[model samples]
Target: MNDSSADSFSPRLLRQAQEGGYRLINAVSLKEQLERGSIFLVDVRDRADYEAGHIPGAICYPLPLTIQARLFKRWWLKKLLCNEGCTNVVFYCQDVNSLRSDSAARAAVISGFPDVYNYPGGLEDWVSRGLALETGPCCEPEHHL
Candidate 1:
């Protein structure tokens, strides 16, 4: 098995991630977020991967480059977020290290959203727990696949 930081789900490290302006949500907390209906869930993976499966209701937008390069193609993305009045933006990707997902969260911060977060375990974790997922275009051409 490939060793990864995601395997080390530590309370102390989670606290540090929070302090560094990144929120880490577990299956339980993620469930709570869904129940509350206050979070904007962003999947930072390619289109094919997303279509194969993903967390239900997650908006696929890829990451960093996509967010910067194709605003018009993803207009509705911003529109929904605007309507949600959401304070938290959650980003997730396939990689457990989630460096890309973390970068996406940082982009959200740069875009002026204060409560940006990262779900490092991503769809891997979501599916492993048997959480239902939604499938569709979910993203723009910028997804690159």
Candidate 2:
């Protein structure tokens, strides 16, 4: 999660994230969870990608910010990402090939969010499954609530 180009992918980071105990979630289960309002979905891709399209109700806490270990522990972030009776945290990126969610999942796990998960299918699988996406730029933080 360096200041590298947005196209960067870190396999090592992904491996470390999985090894850190964040679980993988498939698109089917992700959709079900979303329908039930039982998971807090976070899009960890770049802002542009998020604006282009993303899962509805997903909080656009982009890659570079979500990957930071510091923000995950803050009170404001906890309020933003850990709502709904401490619902599970699910981070996703562009697709399975991207490591943004994995990196963010690892950070969430390290921050003591015991129910963190990574959605590898991401926007691609979601769209392939005919699931809908909300196309628009991110709104103010208060709007997330």
Candidate 3:
């Protein structure tokens, strides 16, 4: 974790947080879940990216501030509204290489949200696979860490 004076992500810390908590999910599995029962999809990308286009039903949580994850020195699990979760929760961002999804999933786990899923392929994969995206605003974060 970096000090608040810094905003860089530490790979080692991210790995430590993930441990056995994060579940790696692909576009296929994500889409299937999206079509079914209670599932919370959180898009951890910047707000603008989310507005441009995002996975349908995703709520924006932005980044850095949401997780702390100590990737930013605070990892405030207590601040997350984990009880608001459904049967499953998935966190996602730009694509495969982004750490945002990993950090967000870790946060959900620490907050005690069960069945946390991390979609590494995120919006890019959703769109690339010819899936539909809801263009306008769907939901936003009412609270954050």
lDDT of 1 by residue, 1-145 (tens): 1112444576654764665566676665676786678777788787788888878878777654554543433443444454446677787898575566766665566566667777777878888888888778765433222
Q: List the residue pairs that clash in candidate 3.
A: 69-75, 70-75
Error of 1 at 12 (Å): 9.7
lDDT of 2: 0.71
Q: Rank the candidates by lDDT, best first.
A: 2, 3, 1
Candidate 3's error at 65, in angstroms? 6.9
Model 2, backbone clash pairs (residues 3+ apart or across chains), number: 0
Cα deviation at 116, candidate 1, in Å, is 1.5
Residue-level lDDT of model 3, residues 1-145, one tens digit each, is: 0011111324543354458476666676677777874577888888888888888888877776543334542144324434443547788899877877777777677666667777776788788999999766635535453
**Which candidate tops TM-score?**
2
Which residue pairs in candidate 1 collide?
none
Greater TM-score among 2 and 3 belongs to 2
Q: Which candidate is the best by lDDT?
A: 2
